[model samples]
Target: MVNIFDNKEYLSFFCFIFFSLFFCVFMLFLSSLLGGKSLSRYKHTPFESGIAPVGDTHLHFSVKFYLVAMFFVIFDMEALYLYVWSVSIVETGWTGFIEAFIFILFLLLSLFYLVRIKALNWTHK
Candidate 1:
């Protein structure tokens, strides 16, 4: 086996990483020491249009909107998987092709079911 420890490239890479980490830590410590001495009392309060905050930060959301968002996210994640399969199509060959087809078919079937069952219907509308 070739001696990896004797390589000049590996030694240079190690030195570069060591210096980068050391510089980062030194800067962070220096900033923490020098930059935190002048904090005002009003700097931490929440400001809203130069007025005091009003009632009820919590607002009601329609379930239909959440349902539509969930469906979009599921389909979006499926598209990402399809993208990965496309990127490595030659490596995965026919087995991957068949599997991806089945996956898409099932996703379509689920979408149809969601539509048929009115899962995506506007409840508030």
Candidate 2:
């Protein structure tokens, strides 16, 4: 039996951790200190294709645009999951097949519901 309180390995581990933390802190502060403190007026402004800043930086976007983007991401992730399931279907056998089938059906139903609610109708929104 070994006494946990008198471990030399633990002391070495603690020293390693402290050294790592000190190195990270030293590098971060050194990089910040080396950076330029001054900034030009033009540099602060947003450069839109080098045409200069036009109008206000803040612009209101349509809710429909955001909704469609979110749905696209959700669907893309669903497809990715389906692809992973397909790859594992051989190893998982019948149970995995049934589960993935149900999952695909659920996603299809969700897509149908979104379509019914006109979530993808960009022209009308």
Model 1: which ten-residue window has the lowest total lDDT?
116-125
Model 2, 27-60: lDDT tens digits are: 9999899977877777676766869666787889
Please list the C-alpha lDDT of all candidates, in the order they appear.
Answer: 0.91, 0.87
lDDT of 1 by residue, 1-125 (tens): 89998899999999999999999999999999888676899887779889977887788987777888888999999989999999999999999999999999999999999989989776543
TM-scores across all candidates? 0.61, 0.67
Which stretch of 10 consecutive residues in model 2 shows the poorest summed lDDT?
Answer: 39-48
Best-performing candidate as measured by TM-score:
2
Candidate 1 at residue 96, lDDT? Answer: 97
Q: Which portions of model 1 show Cα errors greater than 4 Å? A: 1-45, 123-125
Clashing pairs in 1: none
